[model samples]
Target: MEKKHTIAITVEDQPGVFTRIAGLFARRSFNIDTITVGKSEKQGISKMIITVIGDDRDLERVEKQINKLIDTIKVTEMPKKSAFIAELCIIKVAVQDKKIRDDIFSYAKIYDAKIIGMTDKTLTMYLVGESENIESYIRLMVPFGINEISRTGVTAISKDW
Candidate 1:
């Protein structure tokens, strides 16, 4: 069965690690849904949180290829039962009148979104939260005329410690 898998990896702070991983995925025809990489708690180390939708075999192949990379220090699938995950999104939508802008503002407040930019006909909002909230916001803003959107794929940490 194809399902979404969240894999977290700790790797050395070395160049080409991302390229190598991305190349591996491309070679294997694995479609990455989201990938978030950043400096880990320990200096000189980095952590990557990847989300992919694939079958068990496909996921196994991806995991093996990533582990074989020289820069990869540790790799593990985030346990679904005890993981806290979130995504960041920025959306710009057209707002032609005060009533429409006010409606969007109300929705933004409900979603804890911040108005980052505005023009005579548009509003840009920044929202950091679970994917569900972001999706909901997008759905709500569609009626107001979504002009653009960018999303930072899922970043996660295990709650189990």
Candidate 2:
């Protein structure tokens, strides 16, 4: 049975490194659910948090392949129970009437989402939370009509030692 897996990878910061990693995924036929990369604490190195869906054997094979890459320094699987995971979502919802606007604002407050911007016709909200919370908030706004959504896919780190 397949399951979701989040892998944290540390690699040397260099051109073509992302391409190589992406190519590896494509070649192996693994679909990446989300990938977030940024500079790590160490200079000249970068970290990537990638989420994928596959069985244990498949995940093992992919990790081994990633470790073979020249730029790869370390690859570690972050189990949800042992990781602090989050995703960011920016959503613009249509504000058609006073009641709708009030309702939307109320829902945002309930979810602790920030109202980043607003105009006569729309309200833009910024929310950062677990994937499930993000999805739930989006669902609540559907009745109000969503104008646009931009999500920074899952980024995570291991829990405290």
TM-score of each: 0.93, 0.97
Best by lDDT: 2
Model 1 lDDT-worst window of ten = 76-85
Question: Candidate 1 residues 92-160, lDDT tens each?
Answer: 999899999899889889899999999999999899988878998899888888899999998998895
TM-score winner: 2
* Number of colliding residue pairs in each model: 0, 0
**Which portions of model 2 miss their true places by more than 4 Å?**
none
Task: For model 1, state the Cα shift of residue 79 in Å.
Answer: 3.8
How do the residues 37-141 of candidate 2 rate in per-residue lDDT, one tens digit apiece? 999999999999999999999899989999999999999999999999999999999998899989988898999999999899999989999999999999999
Residue 73 lDDT, candidate 1, scale 0-100: 94
- The runs of at least 3 residues in candidate 1 whose Cα sits more than 4 Å from the true structure, single-residue gaps closed, are none
